[model samples]
Target: MAVSHGHKGINFAQTTSICLNFIQEALLKHQWQRASEFLQHYFQALEDFNSQKRQVALQNIWKLGSAILYHHPKSNVETFNAFADRMKNIGVQNYLKISLQHALYLLHKGMVEEAYRNLNQAESWRYGEMSASQEKIIKLIQAYRGLLDYYTWSKKRTELSKFDMDGFATSAATQDMHSYFRQASVNLHEIIKIPGVWDPFVKSYVEMLEFYGDQDGARQVLTDYAYDNNFPSNPNAHIYLYKFLKKEKAPEDKLISVLKILHQIVPSHKIMLEFHMLLRKSKKEEHQKLGLEVLFAVLDFSGCTENITAWKYLAKYLKQIMMEKHLNWVQEGWSSRKDWWPTFHFSYYLAKKNWKENKILALEKAFTSGILLGKGCKYFMYVSKQGHKVQKKSIKTMKKFVMKHNILDSEEL
Candidate 1:
């Protein structure tokens, strides 16, 4: 569809599709700057259009740009810098974020000099009429600047010479360590006070504090970072506190508290084995119950269905629960979770010998999740000694579902 704008016919839909194609072609050839230029032209071509098509096109454009920029390790200074400049010229609202993201990538790659340059550029983007979010980003940019300066100083801490900082040479000599340390400390201090979780910033500050023999300061910052209410939740911040407490030889309750929150937030976290082990050893009745709950959560995850370690823990705990006459867990949460695990399925369609065959069991174990149900295995619907009434009902339901969804029955497979 074409619309007339100032005596010129512009087609928003066609232009958007063509522009995206051009951008993808550039990306396939690793031409970042070319792709960015195409995006800019796309925006300019639709500058005067105010319609649903234009709004949807703009959303797609931003999503494409974000998806491309998120892979920072694949980008370089020259190409990213060119792309960022074009985005800035196009007045992209998140140009600041793009700059900081690339700067972060540079820092991770040990390119402190380039990271510093990019951070400085990001700070420059924080010009007049800043919104609340932009202001927060500016503070983050400053904190990263401090981090970049500290990294630069640490690499040359053995020297007593001048070094480059923000494109100027400074002579802190041996004192550069403390100077950069204080610079980072002050910036991070401001950031933490803003009531948000700054994991990396707070973590780095804690390391510096520990190196400087300030234990109390490290503890305080970590506590605040973990327990703050600025964001919904941050699981790793709890992890940081947990490790720190273990190092400080703090009380068992403190470590347990941290791990409990972490488990609630991320049930499949790899470090949860430590929490499970700790709980399993506790003599408290409540702790044992919590331990069972944790095991169920761990196994419910799709990736963890075959996790042997988790299965082993569940086995030991289930044995303990049965011996203690606690059948409530079986009828409660465990049954729902067990429904998703493939290893416990009971199908009755085959002969008794075939049902007890190890080879058939192994084959079923190799498949994930659904075979024990009435759906995929109409002939062999459950692993139970219960009568044919249940089996017949399962078969009827499975047939209806199969007919509706057009899924192949067991005979076909």
Candidate 2:
């Protein structure tokens, strides 16, 4: 429960817990500086301890390092360097886990040479002492190496202009860079084949292949590393797969599969909107109608009126259907919603018979909503020209509305 350090008996577990609590609280409050101080104190307290204590200390330090990297990147370089030095001083015998963290930090900081040195030191440690997870970490480091090689080569090749190259020189150089990156991609794929390196390993390879204009290759990599039925559960992964499918111009069925996956993952307004857009583009009339049905269902369930854009779209669609079917309910349904009056502006252009009346009504509603004009004399003049046969009550209403809005001075009005 507690370990005595020197002057006072330190409750190691309690102190660690307190430190973690402080770190999380500070992070939640966006106090990165205080969080970093607490983390440093926490890790320093665990130094000079034995293996079990050191493992706990190292894990905390690694987490601290990750927090610094993600949340306080610009100001945490010194913290990262100090952590790296601490890991190095722990010696290769105790450095397997920390090595990957240090290497990643070094790579992020663009110290590729130092990162490789750390990786080499980690590799030279006695293999039999290493756990299976540590072996997986080493494979991930290999994948990181391949990533570094590909990026470095790509940078160099991009710096060379086409005009700077002679005929044979250009051809030869092009072949070399292509071959190098292709090999790097292959090496990354090989690491992916080794199970348990899922997150960054597969993600990085997918990104690299996608960046290199190899959509098919990237899709294949995802398929190979696929998590069986557990797939389509991650919203981000589903979005990525959908993008790839869209890029490939895969059939409507494939796009529908992604929409289904998205529906299963999380039922949200955004997902519904994307499904509607995709179905509309795919020209699946039945599916588009289904998407509208789903939208209406979600609207009823959530009562989410924040999406004015979706409302506008529905209004336009309803207008079209009303014109085609000569349905009064469609027009009434659209006109009843005061919040959606702006959408009827588009309908005015397409309302064949009632175009003029609809246009005037849309403008009137827009003016009343304080949207068309900023309470200027010009706006009042424009409203006057509408010739709405302003009654005394209507004039009183206009004056009250203008006064209630307080949007302009008396002289301005």
Q: Whose TM-score is greatest here?
A: 1
Best lDDT among the predictions, by candidate number: 1
lDDT of each: 0.63, 0.58
Q: What is the lDDT of candidate 1?
A: 0.63
lDDT tens digits by residue: candidate 2, 1-413? 12224426556666676777777888889888778778767775466366777766666666765776567746566766676667656555446667777788788778888887777776666645677777776777667777766666666567655358679878888777777677577768877676543555566667667767887788876655444453334566566666677778888778777667666556563766767666656555566555555444334333443345455455444434433443333323323343443343323232222224443432333233332223443433344334445333443455445444422232322
lDDT of 2: 0.58
Q: Write the per-residue lDDT of candidate 1 for residues 214-307, one digit (tens) a residue.
A: 9999999888888877755888788998999999998766777899999989998877877887787887777767787887788677677446
Cα RMSDs, all models: 11.4, 11.2
- The TM-score between candidate 2 and the true structure equals 0.59
Per-residue error at 83 for model 1, in Å?
4.6
Count backbone clashes in candidate 1: 3
